[model samples]
Target: MAVINNDSSVFQRIPNELANSIFDFLPNRDIKNLRLICRYLDRHVPLRFNRVFISANPLDVKVFLAIANHDTFRKQVKELIWDATLQSPRSCGNDSDDDYGSDEDSSDDNDYQGQSRFQRGCREAIEDAESRLVDKADGNEQQSLLDNLMTSGRALSYYERLVEEQADVLETRADEEAV
Candidate 1:
């Protein structure tokens, strides 16, 4: 019969390679929290999160910039997954066109049209609020906001071009990898 000592840490018992293998299965948030636990974990956890997500949000961009500025953290980054649709729910304003239905009942048609118009109004209101916020921002704040916006726009454009050129090959590779 084999006896195991409970006094010593389980992590200490496990080999470093095995520990790293386990860490690879953890979510990014869990790995980040684990990094805060100890110096050893801090050294390893950042490397596990190689792919960083940069969204259209200002805070996400700031986080990306911080990571980029750090020498150790920057070296750990392997890929950046940019989410351009973070700000708006729908990428385009074609929801109204999709809502059109061939209904004989006038009331039903009226209701559909009313709902479509309401959605459009809501979208416009959001855009207006965003523009107002930008306009009311101070010089430095406005410039920062503009910089973030430009960065997001550039990323989106780059992604679009990549998709246009290599979408089929990328999709096939992704599908093959998934299988």
Candidate 2:
């Protein structure tokens, strides 16, 4: 027999086994919020985001390092996996016939449609940035505009460097060293 009190914490009202099981189903974000919400939940709920992945994307390694360095999560981490999937533009496409998919058309309408979100966003960002700069400059030299474009990822050369840095981090086992 169990006693239920209206004023008690939801966890306190439930059986310990049930409460523990609920933690397993909670989403990572919810778990984080729960931990921050109360010390009781923090001590009771085991770390569920135990597996961390590092990929060519800089964000992946950054997140992995953040979790690996976490005081509580560091002790509970079970696995560190490397995601070898390279971040290439248009990574997916309609491959009904397969055969390496379609090549660029002269019109480029289909090509634009086939581009990944990352590709489109990067292009749009550069265009938007250039437009804004031009508006502010009131006809500054074109060379300065070109330099701004160059620094703004320079057609993804900056992204390539980030990928190279990620590889270096993995090769150096920086994530492992963080714990």
Candidate 3:
């Protein structure tokens, strides 16, 4: 039988640095499980799983948001993997003839009956993530991951060139428009 007690000896046996390293590679779900194991472990897991890779699926976003809502250690995610070529639906109408399934109409009150539930969950998650970021920023002197990426020399130069080209294009367009 395993006993749960606050004998520092239990955790002291494992080195803190090693524990953090182990925690770093864990998937979000596993990380949450490990956190529930003990308070000492909880202290080490950062809020919002800071250095995460979001892919094409919105489900990843949903799960991350779900976890980030409750975690105190996660920071405001600095890098978002934006799909440059994401496709949007051309029409919102429900197609009953489709083979798989049909979507409910946006105007249907029954379809939106659970909307408040979804909204509440999303709101709570954002608020929690915001709080964690504010707390972390207060103590850290280093630039956030987002700031560093935006201001780096290569990125900065690229944007500057792009802006100059845009300005020239805009000036030419204005001349044409005047004519």
Residue-wise C-alpha lDDT for candidate 2, range 1-179, written one tens digit per residue: 23333335577678988887887788888887877766667667766667878765556767877786778877777887877765443335552333323324324221233434444565566557667775555556663654545332344567767767766766787645544
The Cα error of candidate 2 at residue 161, in Å, is: 6.6
lDDT of 1 at 32: 71
Off by over 4 Å in 1: 1-8, 29-44, 86-179
Off by over 4 Å in 2: 1-8, 56-80, 86-121, 125-164, 170-179
Please provide, for model 1 over 18-120, each residue's C-alpha lDDT reduced to its tens digit, 9 standing for 90 to 100. 9978987888887777656655566545654487776544445557777878888888888988654522222456445655443233331112223343334
Winner of 2 and 3 under lDDT? 2
Error at 70, model 1, angstroms: 2.1
The model with the greatest TM-score is 2
TM-score, per-candidate, Cα-based = 0.36, 0.40, 0.30
Q: What's the CA error at residue 34 for candidate 3, in Å?
A: 0.7
- Residue 98, model 3, lDDT: 34
Question: Model 2: which residue pairs collide?
Answer: none
Write down the worst ten-residue block by lDDT for model 3: 108-117
Q: Candidate 2 at residue 84, lDDT? A: 70
